[model samples]
Target chain A: MSTQTVGTAYRPSLGKRVQGWLAGRFAMIVAVLVLLYLFLPVFYTFIFSFNDYRKSNIEWRGFTLKHWANPCGAAGACDSLVTSLEIGLLSTLVATMLGTLVAFALVRHRFRGRGASNILVFVPMATPEIVLGASLLTIFVNGFTQLNGWFGTDLKLGFWTITIAHIMFCISFVVVSVKARLQSLDPRLEEAAQDLYAGPAETFWKITFPLVLPGIVGAALLAFSLSFDDFIITSFVSGNETTFPKFVYVSYLRGIPAQANVIGFSMFVIALALVIIGQIVGNARKK
Target chain B: MSALAHMGGGGAPATAMPPKEPSGRSWLPYLLLLPGVLWLLVFFIYPLAQLFAVSLYSDYPDYPGYYYQDVNWHNYVRALTDFLPHFGRSMLYAGLATFFAFVLAYPLAYAMAFKAGKWRGIMMILVIAPFFTSFILRTIAWRQILADEGPVAWVLEHLHLLSFMPNGRITETWVAVVAGLTYNFLPFMVLPIYASLERADPRVIEAGGDLYANGFTTFRTVTLPMSMPGVIAGTLLTFIPAAGDYVNAELLGSDTGTKMVGNVIESQFFKVLGGYPIAAALSFSLMALILAMVFLYVRRYGTEELL
Candidate 1:
C-alpha cells in the first residue's frame, strides 16, 4: 500500500486522474439519471394532482389545491377507492394466513407432495394475469350458472368474485415471500427454546411467531399492494364494481381526473410513510 | 400440537426425544397445507382446466352465450392464423423493452450495489417508491409525458430529432408502448441484477486487475458473467409481464394497429359476443409458448435452484 501510494503520488498525470475520477463517478451518474427516469412519471403524477383542469387532464393547467382538498369530488372515485381498499385488506388477510401456514408446512415439516405444492405455488406467479383472469371468469360463469340451475339461486360476479381472484393471485406471492423468511430463520433458535424447557406451543408462540411476524407483515403488505393495483384480473371478474385501477382505466379513455392524481399521490405518501416507519422500527430493533 | 413438538425436537439427539412418538398427529402438515392447496386447486388449477375446455367449445349459430363442446381444436388454428401478427408484435415489443430495461438498469443496479455507499438505503427506497403508486396512474402519467406537445416532444423538436421519428411524435406509436413497458418494468430488472451483483465478491473482481486485465476486460469477463443469473432473471421478469401487458398498448399505442395479443384476448373476453372460445384458445397458446420459452431459457442460462 505504501509503495503504491508513493508511485501514484510521484506520477499522477492529468489524463490518469481524469480517468480515475470518471471511473469512480460513472456508475453514480448513471444511477442518478436512471432514478430520475424511474421517478419521472411519479413526479408527473404528484405534480398534476394540483393541476386545475376542467375535463381534460392531459394538458398542464394552472395549479390549484382543490383537487387535493376535495379528492372525492369526482363521482365513483372515492367509492372505487373504498372498494379497492376493502378488496386489498380482505385478500391480504386471507392470503397472508393461508400462505403463512403453507410456508411453515413447506419449510419446517417434512411432507408428501411437497414438490407438487411448490409447483402449484409457483404457477400462478409465472402465468400471465390476462390468462388467469380469463380462466377465472370462465369458471365463475360456468359454476354460477350450474349452481343457479340446481338451487334456484343467483350468484353473480362482483365484489366477492374480485376478492376471490385477488386472493388466488396474491397467495403465490405471499407464500414466496414468507417462505423465504422462514427458510432463512436459524433452526437453532427453536432448538434453544426447546433446550430451555419451553414446550412446543410455548416455543412457537413466543419465539417462532415473533421471528416470522416480520415476514408475514411484509407478505401482507405485498399482497395488499398487488390486490389494490390489479387492473386486468379485476376487470374480468368485477362485473360492475369499479376498483381504483378499473376506475383509472375507464377514465383514461376520457381524461383522468386531477382527483385521481390526488388519490395516487396520497397512496404514494402513505406507502412511503409506512416504509420509513418499518425501516426505523427495524433499525431500533437491531440496536 | 405434539407433532410440532416432535418436529421441533427432531433436530436434537435421539436421547433428547420423548419415548412416546406422536403418531396420531402426523396429519398436521397436510392440515396446515389444506387451505392454500385447496384454494389453488379450486381457483387456479380448476379455472385453467375450465379455460382449456372452453377453448374447445363451439359457439351456437344463433345463440349469443350458448356453446357446445366440440373438441374440434379449430379454435387454436383460427386464433393463430388471425392473431399471428399480434403474437409477433407482443414478442417484439416485449423483447425491445426488456433489452432497453437492461441497458438502463445495469448501471443503476451496479451503482446501488457497489457505489452508493451511505446512500444505498435512499436509492433502494427511490427504486421502490414509484412502484407503490397505482400502476394505471403511472401509465396515465406516461401519456402526458409522451404527448404531442409534451416536454419530450418539445425537446425533440428543439433538438431537431423530431424529423427522424415517423410522425414527429412518440405517442400513439409502438415507440410509446415499448417506452412505457421499459419504464414500468425497469425496477424488476434492476432489483434482481442488483441482488446478484451485490452478492458478487469485490475480491474476485479485483483479482482480474491483478492478473493484468483492464477495467473493461475485467468487467466483461468477470462482472458480466457473475451477474448473468440476475440478468437472466431480470430479463425473464420484464419480458413475461411486458408480453402479457395490455395497459401500455391500450393507453399509449394506436387503438387499431398496435394491438398486442393481450389486447386481443382482453377485447375478446369482455367486448365481443361468443368470443370465449377464441380468447381461451389464444390465452392457452400464449401460456404454452411462454412456458416453452422459459423452459428453454432456464435450461440455457439458469441454475437448477432457480427452476
Candidate 2:
C-alpha cells in the first residue's frame, strides 16, 4: 500500500503481488497448452513421417525419408496429392471470382431480393454437409447421367465434380470475408470517380477495386485453403477424385501413412506463413 | 437480413447514366449482385432444395437408378428411429465439450483481455494461428498424440496414472473426440469470453474488495454479470460446430456407436450404399433439429448479443 511503488503499491504484500502476477499469467500457460493441444496431431504425424517401416505404427523405427521419397510406399499418396492440388486450385479460382463479384454487387448495387441474397451464404453454412453433399451428388448423378449416362456417365468419382463441390463451399467463405470489407469501405469513392468523368467500369478498376483488393486476395487464399482442406463434403461428391484430406481419411483405415506427416508439415508451414504474412502486411497497410 | 437491408441507404450513385434512365443507374447494384446471387442459388439454395427432394424420394438399398421414384417421407421416420441414439450422443458430446470449453476459455480470455497488457496480441495470435492450416490437418495431428503408442497414453500408463483411463489408450475413443472438439474450439470460446471479461474494469472488483468481499465474491458479484454476452457467444460458437462436426468423429471416435449423425449422413451419401433421398431427408431433419435448438437457445438466452 506504499505510494512509492509503481503498479503494485496498492495491492497486497510483495508475495501476494508475485502470486497475482503469476495468476494473471496463468491464462497464458493454458493458452500455450491449448496451442500445443491443437497442433499436437500435426507434430505427431510430422515426427512419425520419418519412421522407416510403413507399419512402424508410430513406434518410430529410426529416422528416414523413405515415405516422402517413395510416395508409392504410402499407397496412392503421390496421386492424391496432385489431385488435391488440381482441384484446390480450380475451386479457388471459381470461389474467389464469384465471391468477389457477389461482394461487389451487394456493396455497390441494390437488386431485387438483396436481403434474400445475403442470406444465401448462411444457407450453406447452416445446412449440414451431409445434406449438401447428398443433394449435390444427386444433382450431379442425375445431370451427368442424363448428359452421358447412356455412356454410363463416367462418374465413378473424379476431379470435376469434386472441384465444383469444393468451389461451392469455398465461395461462401470468400463472400463472407470480402462482403464485410466491402461494407466498411466508403462507397463514396466510386461516386467520386464517376463524377470525375470516369466511366463506371473505369472507376471500379481504378478506385473501388483497389480499396478491398487485399480482402479479395486474402479471401482467395482462404478459399484455396478451405477447398484444399475439406474432407466430409469433398468425400461425398468425390466419385474418384482424392484431395489431400480425403486421402488421409481413406488411408487412415488401411493404417496410417508416413507421408501424411510430410504432406501435413509442408502444408502447415506454407499456410501458416501465408496467414502470418497476410496479417502483418494488412496491419502495416492499415498503419 | 440486417446486413442486406442496410445497404445502399447512404451511398451516392456511383455510375454516371445516359439520359432518360439517369435515376435507374441504381440497377448497377443488381448487376453486381447477380453473379453472387446466382452462385449461391446454384451452389447453395438449389442443392439444398435438391437435398430435400432426395429425402422425400429415398430409394431402397440396391435400387438400380441413382435415386428411386415416388415421394416417401418414411426415410425421415426411419432416420429418426435408427439414428436417434447417434443424435443423442452428438448432443451429449457437443454439450459436454461446450461446457468444458467455456470453463477453460474463461480464465484465458480474462487474462488476455484484462491482465496481459502487452502479451495480448501475441497470445491471441497464437490462439488463432493454428487455424491457418486446414482444420482437418490439425485434427489429424491429434491422431498421433492419442495413438496407443503416443506420448499421452504412454505417459499416463507409465506413470501409473491410468485410474480413470485404464491402460491409458487415447485414440479411437469418445475422450479423443471430446478432446479434439475442445482443443479446436478453444479460441472461439476464448475470444468471446475475452470480449466479455474485458468489459469489466478492475475497479469493479476493487469496489467489491473495498466492501470486504473476497476474490470469489467479487468475481461472482461484478465480473460474471457483465460477461454473460461473451459467455453466450463463446458457448454457441463451440457448441454448434462441435455438434455438426463429422471430422472429429471420423478421426477419433470408434466405428460403432461412436458414429454421429454426421457420419450416418455421410455414410448414406458416399461410403455405405447411398440413399440420396433418404440422406436428403436426414439432412433436412438435422437442419430442423439444429434450428430448433437455436430457437430454444434464443428464447432462453437473448439472441441479439450471442453473436
Q: Which candidate is the best by lDDT?
A: 1
Give the per-residue lDDT of model 2 (tens digit) for A211-247.
8886778677767766777776777788766777877
lDDT for model 2 comes to 0.69
Native A-B contact fraction in model 1: 0.58
Weakest lDDT window of 10 consecutive positions for candidate 1 chain B: B1-10
Record all residue pairs in model 1 with backbone atoms less than 3 Å apart, i.e. clashing.
none
lDDT of 1 by residue, A110-168 (tens): 66687788788877766888999999999999999999999999899999999999999
TM-score of chain A of each: 0.91, 0.83
- For model 2, give the TM-score of chain B: 0.82
Stretches of model 2 off by over 4 angstroms after superposition: A1-23, A68-75, A107-112, A150-156, A186-207, A283-287, B1-22, B58-68, B106-125, B128-140, B158-161, B166-169, B187-237, B270-277, B295-307
